[model samples]
Target: MAAVKGCQFSASLSGSCYVMRPRLHRFSVKVPFFDGPLRSRLVSLCCHNPNPDSFIVDQTVPLSKNPTHLPDDCPQASASSPSSAIDFLTLCHRLKTTKRKGWINHGIKGPESIADHMYRMALMALIAGDLPGVNRERCIKIAIVHDIAEAIVGDITPSDGVPKAEKSRLEQAALNEMCEILGGGIRAEELKELWEEYENNSSLEANLVKDFDKVEMILQALEYETEHGKVLDEFYLSTAGKIQTEIGKSWAAEIHARRSSRLKNKLN
Candidate 1:
């Protein structure tokens, strides 16, 4: 009996002879022998093709080599390709173009897109102070992906008629799809984990990032009111006196003071 590497064989009884079939490599072998142990004859079984079109399997066939070894044009060979990353990049473009509907519904013209909001929140995370034992890098990442699912589900405001649980379910599904588009590597897993953390609001980093989120929104609202001269009192009211972190509270307080002075000056 001879054992061959990279190939497996099984015996089938046909009439009074035994037939041996290779398990893979898109080729078959028929050996006819009697009821005695055969020795050393099953060698030289290379399915290496001399011509490309010589072998065809109708069903899903296991390859003798790793799937990555297939020719460049084969789809399985491109399974690990960066094309999926490109698709995710393309999807992210929507984040840059889709305006935060909260502002749009309030009639704020030329409102900031979701990416604009995340960018400032990420910057806040970068310069965040007094976060003892907190991971700043992870907070930045959480800010970046915190609203990423909105690229697919759009920004669901509290008054958007979407139940909180339903909105979370939709956003979670969208996040999974986006992560899959990135081909599910370590970076994708990290972003998915960060996004889940933000969604859960369970960690110190997530708590701080949530504060950054509200602070950024209010900051944007303040800027919009200053530039456009439209009193966005509702925006101020939404986040007023409710910021969770000391940094967020201080920033919100300063913004409110500036807004109040501007209103007083306007009245005067």
Candidate 2:
């Protein structure tokens, strides 16, 4: 199957249908990069659009008509419910806006988009939970919902050094806005409590999830550095000291040592 802006398509010898596309294009580890396609220029092979509205799916993938492509597990979106129209996953699927006139994004590019980042982070929290103790499911739920507000507010990198008071204000407002999607009440309260727990690092789970957050960044930088060069190591180092938990600290050291050894290997 060939990939255009996002969709992939293939039809078989016996009239079989295949629609698997590379949904994870964002996870590139290659360099010598080139420009991504312009949205208007994408071509859909064997796909027809006599009128712009004829095709429901965006040129991008997950290839379902609904934006999020309602997982087989997700309740089928009712045609009547307009709120279900929002496609969080597809929005996340689109690559970050390029910051400059180059291949990579500057402001919020490498950092995973809100939904994408949260999904992986949640999975990591669940999978990499501190054994014999912390509540992985609770931590995962927190990580998942933690940054849903970011879609509206945009990524606020920790390094921006925004004042804690201002940041908290912005975050609270963002959360309030998102809770509106579900009509906040006791249900929203539970999610907000989890967010607070994470923000305050009040629980072992929260602290662990926080570590996963940093770990994800470190891993991303390492991939970038791998494709680019050792020059990217500085990015990793900058956040290393900020990690609070022992696990995060240990992981940072391992990443550092590995980076150093890789550099040495290249030199040799």
Candidate 3:
């Protein structure tokens, strides 16, 4: 649409674009999206208010004089604003209903949701004790958010044939979108940092969370095997040598021992 005179258009982080018109000569609308003579004209109208709180949006001025067409809720840019935080929370609700595709595709009946998987991983983090240099709180946070991106991108397993780089890119984009809902504040940055750390598998907490992830998978596999009388040895094969923490390794050993004893007893 063509630009309107005495009005400026800008893109909002909420994925919508809108136009604002000055309500009074005392305040100026900063339209970062415009260019050329129009940009200079709008710049001249922008008020240099020392107090940020004084800046107000004139929502009545629509992008193309069509007020009804703009985004329903005009969200504030402040990180601490309730609108942004609420938007983020609303996005997280999807994870609770989205099932983990890996288990479903493997023919595991009544597979768990993504939230269910993360819940068990978080519990694993909570009960984990006495790691010499590890921070258990960090582990819990990492475990909770590790699969958060899957809420947006869904669970992409190795069997999906997506390249590792491509999968990472997709998940990262989804994570960024999710964080954007939180207004890209300190909390958002921390979430990104922990998620990246888990992705890299380089830190102690990350390593512990990674092992916890595999441990959760194998434990679930064992449960399915016993409950359904189906052999899920492939899950064991996948995690055989990948667990990183001593605690994880020990848990894996116990899980394996129990499975072996059960099979041996059946044979006898």
TM-score for each model: 0.69, 0.57, 0.69
- Candidate 2 lDDT over 93-186, as tens digits, reads 3324312111134332454445555666777776663666777788888887666556555666555678877877797887776556544433
Report residue 254 deviation for candidate 1 (angstroms).
Answer: 1.0
CA RMSD of each candidate after superposition: 14.2, 18.4, 12.4
Clash totals in order: 0, 0, 1
Candidate 2, residue 40: lDDT: 12
lDDT of each: 0.72, 0.54, 0.75
* Alpha-carbon lDDT of model 2: 0.54
lDDT of 1 by residue, 22-78 (tens): 234556443323344421111123233333243333323232222322333332323
Off by over 4 Å in 1: 1-80
Which is superior by TM-score, 2 or 3?
3
Model 2 ranges with Cα > 4 A deviation: 1-111, 129-132, 158-161
Looking at candidate 2, the ten consecutive residues that score lowest on lDDT are 25-34
